[model samples]
Target: MVRSTNSAVRQDAAPAVSERQQSRVAKRAAAAKPAVKSEPIELPQDIDSSTAFQLIAASIFRQVGANEGAVRSANPQGVHQMRIGLRRMRAAISVFAQLVDDPETTRLKQELRWLTGRLGPARDLHLLALRLRRARGAAPERQKRLQVVETMRNEALATAIAALATDRYRKLQTDVWAWIEAGDWLGGAARRQVPRRARDFADAVLAKRARKIARRARELEALDVEGRHQLRIAAKKLYYAMGFFESLYDGRKSRERMADYQRKVKELLDHLGALNDLAVQQQLTGSLTPVVRQSDGLAVIAPSRHERTKTERLLKSAGRAGRELADAKSFWD
Candidate 1:
């Protein structure tokens, strides 16, 4: 997505919540029964599918902007907020796609996937760096070295930021904005052509990738190590597809089974993600070390031998998870 001109206005201006407020909110949420919060403004019962979808799409865009702002501003809470926004946007798309019959929904999903993928590495690195920083004070000599490592990490982060802020990201963002503004999500089929049978929508969506994934899951069981890795990618795409539409199906047994499948895919994805992160950090840290120690550059590259070891372990752990995802009995089960 292109960066908005009103970046400041794009973000919510609310002050940061204190720990006390967070505790209270958590308590309230935990004490409540599961319920969907009603929107402040009620949507008309007779509203057209296209209209309803446009409203949801607008919300999705706004949320995406907020997340992007979080990333650009280097705010941790903003980052969390952005991740939540992405999840909610995904959920909303999955739920409402039932009402509106459009292939563009799939296209938008692909766009979301792209946007989220770009942010994923940056978020992971930031989280890992924060974790490492918290542990640094306990080891004095190590602390000094870790601080050096952190300086290099910051430089690497800046590079990621520069990439995100470039024209490419902006162009994508602008294209998405144009779509939302013009309601391109309501493509091809007219609103009047859509039937009232929600089941039809669910069927269309469920059938989207269900058969292929099931076959792939079976194939995954018989593949060699590399083949299994390939299979896991298919599994993840299908899992995300399922996750997108899980809200529409409430059949007790099926829902439970789908949830299980989603969890398995998520586990595997997390593993792949960790492996990716470690590789990035290792490559980045290695590159920055020479640059930072040079006579004319920022003096930051100071990763300790131990920190490098941690990166290796992270990579190894990811490899194991990838293998498990590929080799597990009943990749679907």
Candidate 2:
């Protein structure tokens, strides 16, 4: 187990940001009309494997377009939504990598990566500011400086907006759409290799993912933190895969079966998410304390004295959740 040097005490020292404040940050980035010309793409009810990939990619692409207006306005939610759209697009591209291995798909993925990078600083700073907001317990004088946090957010937003205005960003929209609509992968040898059966593909992919999660869960008693993080990633991938193939579950019984599967998967995923958040904060908590504490004499909160205890509890919960997921029935079959 690779232990994080940043203790829970350090994490506790970060001030609490209110939900209202976070919402305001998202709203402050001024908006204008969407710059992209792409129309919204809708996914059909039933789909084959390749069609499913194309539909997901297209829908996410449409999300980027729809959010562009608010994003241009500098809405934080717009940035968040567009960022999600990028993430989902990237996931689809990865899942379907064998099918879409041409130069164009590679280039588009790279461009999306670039945009994601550009958006990351603003998003991270926004989160830091919100997350570092002091909870009710601390003295008002010791709270993290909301003003300074907002200033940093503005600066990061400027960079994001500038990147969005570039010719490359504009071209990425058109190019990626063209690739999705008429990729060489749609026909010939590629099509022959990649089957059109969404149901079969979903079963194989999800079953493999579930097996990994099950294997990891059963062995959690012996694994380290990094080893468990891999489990969380697997869970997330399986969750996303389930979402993509959900429409294929056609009957009332099938849909009910899917609903139960979704609920169980969500529970497992949430627990996994909690573990990942703690692990990330463990590395970041102590390093961030000084900067958050010193900005214009604002005092940061004290690190939680009980951090070690909390970590132990969280790990235990993750273990239980992992076991539960491993034991759950297959939704894909």
Candidate 3:
């Protein structure tokens, strides 16, 4: 009798969480209120890279799990938190990519990307609906559009909920936890690098990512939509990277410098985020049928003059923020 490869893989995989246990966890999550913000992870200054990575990954996993019940209930903030958690987890993986370059890590990343994709639409639609509600006018047409957005958001949320309940998701969670604890990356050639001091690792990663952002910032105004979007992503990754090492800089002076660095990066991210939101709003608005005028039969869907002005203002603000970030001193220095 020959053993099957599938059976071999199954034997090696982490034990799946039972459905009954999952139900109890879900109930606990549902009863708890979602955290308003991500709490900072505090790692010791002398911790090894592998240990630091594990702590960061564990914090992110907990965040993702904490929001599941709220997501099932269609809570907008829950959706946002869960999405951010996933994004941060992906960034963390990238930061530690060199030490975790195993096949299992790649497979886990693919699964995470799939889960993030499932949750994206709902978050985007929810933001769009909020924007529409906050607009100056309360026209019936606007209300109708808002209703359509809500319907789409509900559907998206339903899909996200279904995704959370899937066996694939359960296995993904189990495997991720297993990987964080004792993945293959911890053994073999990578083991040598994993034990390196996190501060040294932090300094190298921060300086490298910062350089990329600085290079992009130099021509901020000249960047087109796609370029700006890429800049936003780089800034976001750098921000998450910074958070991972915040606890390593614990001295009063170091803390202050780190705080300033974080503030500058965050400012840049905020401006870029606003710009992205404007683009997304434009895309969402364009997808809807415009309110038509009876007399001239013209489409009334173009962005309002106010919106055009806001866009111009946001562009200027984003450019300024980018420049400021470029000039700011690196805390890791």
Worst 10 residues of 3 by lDDT: 1-10
Using TM-score as the yardstick, the better of models 1 and 3 is 3
Deviation in angstroms for 228 in model 2? 3.4
Q: Which lDDT tens digits does candidate 2 get at residues 97-196?
A: 7667777778888999888877755555566556557435565543545555565566556556666788999899888898888876676434456656
Q: Judged by lDDT, which candidate is best?
A: 3
The C-alpha local distance difference test score for the whole of candidate 3 amounts to: 0.77
Angstrom error of the Cα, residue 164, model 1: value is: 9.9
Query: Native-vs-model 1 lDDT?
Result: 0.49
- CA deviation > 4 Å runs, candidate 3: 1-36, 189-195, 290-300
Q: Which stretches of candidate 1 lie over 4 Å from their true place?
A: 1-59, 68-73, 80-125, 134-145, 148-178, 184-187, 190-239, 295-333
RMSD of each: 10.7, 6.5, 9.5
Flag the better candidate by TM-score, 2 or 3.
Answer: 3
Number of the candidate with higher TM-score, 1 or 2: 2
lDDT (Cα, tens digit) per residue for candidate 1, span 1-333: 111212211122123434554444334334432212212222343444455445555655565565554455444444445554555556556655544435655766676665554444434445555655775457554354455445433333333344457787677567666665564545553644454444344355455545554455444434444454555455555554454344555567666766665666677567545544444555444443443456344454455687678756754654555454344333121
242, model 3: CA deviation in Å? 0.9
Candidates' lDDT values, in order?
0.49, 0.65, 0.77
lDDT at 211 for candidate 1?
55
